[model samples]
Target: MNHFQDYTNNRSRLARIDASLFFAPTSCTPLENSVLWIAGCRPSSFIRFAYALSGLDIQFHLTDFLEGKRIGDLTTQQMTKFDELQGETIRKERNLCSRLASLQEDIVDQPFASKIFTSKNYEEEDHHYQFENADEALDEHSQHMAGVMEEADELRMKTLKQIVINILEPVQAVEYLAAAKRMRLCFQQWGKKRDHHHSNKLD
Candidate 1:
């Protein structure tokens, strides 16, 4: 895969949960701008919580093995292992929704409340209201990030098509060509709608 496609694929997976953050509660601790909740063993399995964090204006930190100690810390082989663990966690969570009800309740209720109560500082030097307009700024920043991602997706598609042309083997080249064509159709159809929806939210 070309750089853009690979990046876009990864980014798309992350972006899928962008809407979940809407229901997340704000942080109560003034020093900590975000909270990291690790509900599953895999990175993707933690996506819902991540989105929840995003929606709340909190940065979601993945604690799965795949997430590791730092960004780019996991090798491809290690990530594959983490991915398997995450898959298992997701399956169990899906099947045992009732069993995990209390955990979910606590996450949504108590932790959220505490995070907000303790982190409500919006004061500025000389007693000014620095955060009075925070919500509006956040909305604008979200829109800007969404636009950047859209541009990245477009570039990814173009790069992938270029790679498809460079494949020398007839069979391999045909396969990539077909894949590239499908990606193009999917992007052309969904790209504008997605971008517009996100754009309108900032206004």
Candidate 2:
């Protein structure tokens, strides 16, 4: 095996070797680039998303993420008003994600539905008849979660934009997006390592 240093005189070939080991998240995903895409999500959109989403880690509750509450005048009055108008949809979205993504089932996560679809009570097979539409239910619930997540992303960006306009000076605000992107990358890498370590332990 030739050492990489052997390619020092061949700068182009050395760069190729270095790049082969590197994975860039900025480029569009193959699924995103497909001409006849079936997933309905556009490739360019996913490219922008994958590159920038980590910049704003907005969860369901706007205030719960990234000290988001401090960004603007997002108040209890606003939340209460939102609930009064679109509370049910928001509730369903939160409920669905909590149930689907949770390792343990929670009653708070199940409001309109009963315990039948809850994964935690699998031992209670007596309720199997109730979840006859388990597959369909899970899919519908998951869509709700996705919708909420997308909305949260919009709100996060909106909040950040306002912060840049109001709170920060012209210079610092300009650098925020790039800084957020780097922070996100670091967080994602650490999360991957942690998950890998946990999986190894399980094995």
Candidate 3:
């Protein structure tokens, strides 16, 4: 029966591939080009601030990622704060993407809802009612999780697309998009293999 493994696997893989595309080379690209990668990130802004503190040199200091230096060694507070700020930056980027291209639209188009609800009908008559109730519960949980993941995926993809477009211009953006699509397809195959492996374990 159609389920996450059968149907929604493709989209989930796409999301991961998108994230990797954006994140993998961002740090090593030329600073000017990388600026586009960090356009709305808190960590980027924080790093910039730190760069300024270090006299705007190309080299970044460890102190930049930290907050204050009251005791000589790096404090957990600094690391945690840096992580939090970075997280906020990602959150804002995702939110902006939602407004810009309606990422939610694509996310909602995934076939998980229909698959989950309809697949339960295949249950034998004796278990049909029981399966129906259980399926409804599963569907509810899946829907909620899918909504969240979909939003996150859209944000990640948009961010990656925007960065690649900025760095490579229109032509390269198209190529990158194509690559991202292929990567997603690969992810689907990977997920199917994994799901099958897990299913075998259960059997």
Top candidate (lDDT): 3
106, model 2: CA deviation in Å? 10
In what order do the candidates fall by TM-score, top score first? 2, 3, 1
Candidate 2: Cα lDDT at 122: 60
Candidate 3 lDDT over residue span 1-203, tens digit each: 12323333565555343433333334333332333332222323433333333333336552333332111222355445435544665677556555534433533444434443565566666655322344444455445444545554444444443334333345434443454345345555665676678889999
Q: Which stretches of candidate 2 lie over 4 Å from their true place?
A: 1-131, 199-203
Q: How many residue pairs clash per model?
A: 13, 1, 0
The window of 10 residues in a row where model 3 has the poorest summed lDDT is 65-74
**Which residue ranges in model 1 land beyond 4 Å of their true spot?**
1-130, 166-169, 174-203
Query: Where is model 3 more than 4 Å wrong at Cα?
Result: 1-161
Q: All candidates' TM-scores? A: 0.25, 0.34, 0.28
lDDT of 2 by residue, 1-203 (tens): 02222432343333233321112222433322242211122222321222233233244342333343222333454335333433443454465446435512422355425545567646555644444345554545545444433443343333444334544445544444445555455555666676678889999
Cα miss at 184, model 2 (Å)? 1.0
lDDT of 1 by residue, 112-151 (tens): 4444444244444555433333444345444444444444
CA lDDT, candidate 3, residue 104: 36
